[model samples]
Target: WVINIVRFYKVYCDVEPKRQALSKANADLAVAQDKLVNIKAKIAHLNENLVKLTAKFETATSDKLKCQQAAEATASTISLANRLVGGLVSENVRWAEAVRDFKQQKSALCGDVLLITAFVSYLGYFTKKYRQDL
Candidate 1:
């Protein structure tokens, strides 16, 4: 009976260390599980942010495309307006020159009319040969 008691005491000593190791392993497992839960939550938050950023990027791209088209249209309009102005400016120069020519012709027309009337009256008293010479 005494030998059996000593053997049981030895077995109890061996099991004590194994029990302590088991407790430490359980504590480490709990900490690892908590860390895993926190990492998953962080991943979920990052995914949400990524979705929002992607939407904003798409909106900005569309806005940039619209603005580019508007700018192109405005440039086309300006080009057409410049061409129209160029045509009108050329026409203005032609009109001014024609007006100047008409004014000069008007000043000379009075003297020409007077000379024609005097010649017609003076030639009525002359023979055809003398009128032709005059």
Candidate 2:
């Protein structure tokens, strides 16, 4: 009985239209499977690219942070240098004033010395005349 059923099914499936339809369906399934495999490979490649891009982004972020820190340090150094320059200018101004004061004092001292020398000369001449008279 099973043999008879198998023969009937085989004959029905062996018709030209049925055989062509089955063959076309099998080909379509094979193409679909191949497309699935290619899609999966593309997905894997895209995942690897994502990982690489993530690493590059992280490195770029770290480098940017370092640059910011360097900029801050440079700013502080510039501020300190400016302060030092201001201090030097102040000291130079004080030194200049002191020099002017010293010159003024020296001139006054020279005038006083000239006056004392003239008075001593006059006294010396008057005593010499008195001794001659005696």
Candidate 3:
């Protein structure tokens, strides 16, 4: 009976250590599981943030494209406007030259009209003087 008691005590001692080790291992596993859960949550949050950032990037890209197109269109419009201004300037020069020519012709015609008027008056005076003498 003493031997049996000794044997049982030895078994109990071994089992006690094993049980304590198992408990500690379980506690460590629990800590590892909690860490894993936290990491997964963080990954999910990061993924959500990534999705939002990606959408923003896409929107920014689209806006950049639109702005680029607008800038190009504006540049072309300015180019056309400049061409039109050049054409208008040329037209203005032509019109000014025409006006100058017309003015010169008008001056020449005015001198001719004055000479003709004086000749007609002289003829009329001679007719009256001759009739008086007759």
Candidate 4:
């Protein structure tokens, strides 16, 4: 009975440490499960934000494309206006040069007529003087 009691006590001591180790492992498992739950919640929240950000990014891209199209249209309109203005300026310059050339020709013709008339008058006076002297 004495030997049996000592063996029993030794067995009990070994079982106690096993039980404590099991309990510690169980506690660690519970803490790990809690951490996993929190991490899952964070992942869910991050997924929701990612969805929202994707939608916002699409909207921004659409708006940017529309703005670029509008800018291109404006640039085309300005280019057309510039071309028209250039054509009009060129036409006006041509008209001004033509008018200047016409005025110069008219002045030259007038000068030629005046010289012819003076020469005719002098010729008539000299012919009358020659006839009277003869």
Best by lDDT: 1
Count of backbone collisions within predicted model 4 = 0
Q: Per-residue CA lDDT of candidate 4, range 77-130, in tens?
A: 999999999999989999999999999889798788899898777677677768
Candidate 4, residue 73: Cα displacement in angstroms equals: 2.1
How large is the C-alpha RMSD of every model relative to the true structure?
9.1, 10.9, 9.9, 11.8
The best candidate by TM-score is 3
lDDT of each: 0.94, 0.91, 0.93, 0.93
**Cα RMSD of predicted structure 2:** 10.9
lDDT score for candidate 2 against the true structure:
0.91
User: Model 4: what TM-score?
Assistant: 0.60
**What is the per-residue lDDT of model 3 for residues 30-93, given as tens digits with 9 covering 90 to 100?**
9999999999999999999999999999999999999999999999999999999999998999
- Window of ten residues with lowest summed lDDT in model 2: 125-134
TM-score for model 1? 0.59
Per-model TM against the reference: 0.59, 0.55, 0.66, 0.60
Q: How many clashing residue pairs, candidate 1? A: 0
Query: If the candidates were sorted by their lDDT against the true structure, best first, what order would they fall in?
Result: 1, 3, 4, 2
What does candidate 1's lDDT look like per residue over 29-112, in tens digits? 999999999999999999999999999999999999999999999999999999999999999999999999989989999998
Clashes found in each candidate (C-alpha, N, C closer than 3 A): 0, 0, 0, 0
